[model samples]
Target: MLQETRLIMGMPITICIAEGGAGARSMAEAFGYFDAVDRRFSTYKADSEISAMNAGRLCRDAISAEMREVLALAEKTRVDSDGYFDIRRPDGSLDPSGIVKGWAVRNAADLLREAGHRDFFVDAGGDIQADGVNEDGEEWRTGIRNPFAEDEIIGAVRLSNRGIATSGNYARGRHIYNPRQPGDELDDIVSMTIIGADVLEADRFATAACAMGADGIYFIEETAGLEGLMVNAAGISTQTSGFGAFEIQ
Candidate 1:
């Protein structure tokens, strides 16, 4: 097995291949893709495409195809989630921070699959995309961390060619926006984990659910091919009926 972590796009991106070191080159190329993604998408960087657009230096029509696609996807999420998944920052600038990690991770995962890598995982922060089995010949296990307690796991998910994403204050503080109040802090929910058909959709919905407060679980329940768990500030939990199907238990 070959596994490594690299800091990219302002997060620890861990890539694991269930093969020998011969997969190292592909993994390196995967990281290179991540690097390029960061250079283009990082909102904090003054030269990034997002920053350029926010600074009014880059025209929206002149943006790269990937940037356009990401923004388009963000807009779709905003619509699908009824504006809860919007990327408009407090400063009134576009910030696709919500879904870029999953998007980029999905891209890397696709690289592995295209290269005939059957068993691999690309994890960007808590958003994960994995396929096939691990070294143990079992599904990849993703622990959903406790929001109120560091290093404590509240649950574990068994992913088989699926994607999982957890959104909480622990990873990025209250970075998630409550679009209804615009600039108001998220108070109703402390954390939310979403398991979906793919990481891109999962992460976007997770962000939207975080903004939806405890009611987000209902949103996931109603959505097709998605299941979710939401924990409120008081530690009360709720989840879709099928969510337990992904549990590692």
Candidate 2:
């Protein structure tokens, strides 16, 4: 097994390959992709493409291919979530941080797969894209951290060829807000975890659901191919009907 962790995109990204065939070069390639993504999409950097676009230095017609793809996905998520998932800030500036991490993680995973490495895990911050088995030869067990207790894990979910993401203000502190009510803080729901077919799907919905507050779990319940667990401010936990199927005993 080969594992590496690096700080990229203002977060720690870990990539673990549970096989021997893929060497250090494969891992370097994956991490390099993440570095390129950060340079292109990071809003915190003055020279990033996103920053240039926001500053009016770059026009939409002149944006790169990756920028176009991220924008399209952001628009799709906004429409799918009824404008709950949006990248546009109250000031009309764009910040695609909510979706970029997961998108980058998924792309990194694809890069590894293209190199013929199947059993691997890619985690960008809290969003994860896991395929095949872990080093123990069992399904990847991803834990959901307790919102009230940062050091404690509430539970673990078994994932194989799937993605899981958690969205909450506990760690980041009031980073997500309802697009409809920009000023209203999403204080009702402290945490929301979504599992989907891919990291991008899981991440986009998790952000949207967190913005929905207590009603987010219901949205996950109604959405097909997605299972979610929601923890409210009172520390009460709620989950979808199929969530149990993915939970690790």
Candidate 3:
């Protein structure tokens, strides 16, 4: 079965799943699961888990099992990124949007696998996770949009059972602010793409790496099981060790 549907998550959530005979039905079920997770974890919602934590009604000790895992990952990312991937805003509010979307998408992919779909793809607003190749037997091809060029692709990558996430200043029009340097704007880097086994890690790494500018490349390269490529404001490109395998076409 192969099915596609939209789940509500402060917006339309389009979910797609491919399986033998129950693709549609299974995807619908997965959407239900996704909706539940969204309601519980969404930062946009006033009553979501993260909102609760921000309100002081819940702490990390009182978080749900699923959120506990996400929090742990967030903590690890904050450490690995040298505090660049923080969840707290300058005003002391939790802003997990950088990592939660990818986390949810990856979890949806896991649900699809549990439903017997060996191959699937989940794209939650550009954060992507693929379990296997597409129907053509080739790896998934992801485009790296050119920030300065309209309708142009600067590069692309072929991914297999991997997660790819991009953080760019272009998407939100300078909305990706740096909490550490509240008075300073993030310049020099236009976008950063990170690929890794975990979508959450990839997402946070990309965001933090973009904030770090040129200095972040070395950290991403040395981090085990992670690789990244960055496109700076001047359009200069730099990539880590394993990043060469993903072609820039």
Q: Which has the greatest lDDT?
A: 2
Q: Tens digit of lDDT per residue, candidate 1, span 1-249? A: 999998877778999998745789889999999999989989889989899999999887799999989988999999999988888989889988888988998999999988889888999988999888988988988888887676899888898788889888444435443445443444467788999888888899999888887678899999999999887655667889999988877
Our tally of clashes for model 1 stands at 0
TM-score of every candidate: 0.90, 0.92, 0.83
Query: Tens digits of per-residue lDDT for model 2 on 1-249?
Result: 998899987788999999955557888998999999989998999999999999999988999999999999999999989899999999999999899988998999999899998788999988999999988899998999887666899999999999999998454335443355444443478889999999999999999999887889999999999999998755679999999999987
Shift in Å, residue 60, candidate 2: 1.1
Error of 3 at 71 (Å): 1.8
Candidate 3 lDDT tens digits, 1-249: 254647466644555554446687667777788788878877778898888988888966778898777777788878878988888789887777677777888888888888788777887766778777767667777787775574898878887788888787654335444455533433467778889886767887888887677777777898888888887755678889888788755
- How many clashes does the backbone of model 2 have? 0
Better of 1 and 2 by lDDT: 2
Select the stronger candidate by TM-score from 1 and 3.
Answer: 1
The number of the candidate with the highest TM-score is 2
Kindly give the stretch of ten consecutive residues in candidate 2 with the minimal lDDT sum. Answer: 169-178
The C-alpha lDDT values of all candidates are 0.86, 0.89, 0.75
